[model samples]
Each structure stands twice: as C-alpha cells, then as structure tokens.
Target: MQDHISSLNIAPMHSPWIEFRPNRPDAQARVLCFPYAGGSAQVYHALARGMPENVELGAVQLPGRWDRRREPLLTRLSDA
Candidate 1:
C-alpha cells in the first residue's frame, strides 16, 4: 500500500483543499471525494484505483485531519 501511494504523482490544487492522486491533465471528467467526519483523504485511495483512466479522482483534505491536523477545522460551510 505504501509503495502504491508513493508511486502516485500527486498534484495538489490549493494544498489545503484538494489533492489529485496521480493527476490526469487530460481526463474527460473529475470526481471529488469527501471523507466522513474525522476521516482523511486516505479513505478514497481504493476508490481512486477503480476510477477509469479518463476520469480523475480528487480527494478533499479537510482541515484538522491528517496532514492538516495543525489547521483549525471549518466552523461554517462558507469557510470551507
């Protein structure tokens, strides 16, 4: 699992918000996945693998979790 994750070419758009796992610049579509409360981007790893090559899978890295643990969580929808 570590090897697979490390091999991905991550392209983070606004680092705090979205992360494309193995970015596909010419993908025909994109899917943004959000984790359950208190969950992290890792939740979408398996899903990303199943995605078609023409579709990009992006995971939302909410604040206060995982690598963003140091950041404060969003209290309002507008802040997100």
Candidate 2:
C-alpha cells in the first residue's frame, strides 16, 4: 500500500498525523481536514474527490482510529 501511495505521490506530512489522499506536489493550496468524533481519515474521501485539482487534500488521522486503533487515544488538545 505504501508503494502504491508513493507511486501516486501521496505523501504523509507526518506518518502519524496527516494522510494525504492524493498529494499534489505542485498544488497551489493545501487543505487539512479533520474527521468528526469517532471518525477516521477515510471520512474525507468524498471531500478529497470533490476538491479542485489545484487544491491538495490531507486527512488528519487521529490515533485510536483505523490503523491506529491499538494506539492510545488522545484525551486533550495539548496531548496532540
């Protein structure tokens, strides 16, 4: 999966923080999206698809969700 993402130029800002759906190296703007309560990075899939070509979409992947289900959940903003 990592190889596939790399091929499409989807690079994570910080592997544990932001997951770019389809990173655009030459994008004119970047939008970082956060999921709702109990949601995961996938929640932004549709938004990513609807964004303009020049706008890059990055989905924030909070710990304790999705692949990070085993990790401890952050209880405070300061913990992030």
Candidate 3:
C-alpha cells in the first residue's frame, strides 16, 4: 500500500514540521519556533521584522491547532 503511494509525487512529512513559506536559502542562520499552547505558526509571521538579513525563521505548529488539528495532540512535553 505504501509503495503504491510512493510511486506518486506525494511524500510524508518529517517531524518538528516547519511551514512552507518562501525560504531564505542564503540565510546564515535559521530560527525554529514553538508557539504557546493554543497558538499557531502565524504567531511568528511578524517576527521577521528588524531581524538581520542573514536570519531565517521557521515555526512549528503543534498538533490540534491550525492546519494540523486533524493530527493528535502532544500528550507529553518531550514528545513535542
């Protein structure tokens, strides 16, 4: 079953999922963000302001919120 799906362009997402906005490939550094409970990746949308040009940012959306709501919630902090 999995093999059949792999034949297509579809691919599974890896963990600590990041948003798919246009990325800054030349960035010297990257930021991995985690919002407070009940918050979504959108919280960091405005965080780019005033940051250095070499800095890039990525936000992690916890389960049960935003687009990932269909997924299960993190039952433990370490699991997040």
**Alpha-carbon deviation at 17 in model 2, angstroms:** 0.7
**Which scores higher on lDDT, 2 or 3?**
2
lDDT at residue 34 of model 1 (Cα atoms):
88
Ranking by TM-score: 2, 1, 3
User: 50, model 3: CA deviation in Å?
Assistant: 4.9
lDDT of 2 by residue, 1-80 (tens): 74553356443354678887777766566788889888999988888888888678888888999988898999999976
Predictions in order: lDDT: 0.78, 0.79, 0.67
For model 3, give the 10-residue run with minimal summed lDDT.
Answer: 5-14
Q: How high is the lDDT of residue 64 in model 2?
A: 95
Cα miss at 43, model 1 (Å)?
Answer: 0.1
Best candidate (score: TM-score): 2
Over 4 Å off in model 1, which ranges? 1-15
Candidate 1 lDDT over 37-70, as tens digits, reads 8799888988888888867888999888888889
User: Tens digit of lDDT per residue, candidate 3, span 1-80?
Assistant: 74553354423234547762335665555667878878998888888554566566778878888888898987998986
Report the alpha-carbon TM-score of model 3 versus the true structure.
Answer: 0.65
- Report each candidate's C-alpha RMSD, comma-separated, in the order given: 9.1, 8.5, 11.1
In model 3, residue pairs whose N, Cα or C atoms come closer than 3 Å (at least 3 residues apart or on different chains), thus clashing, are: none
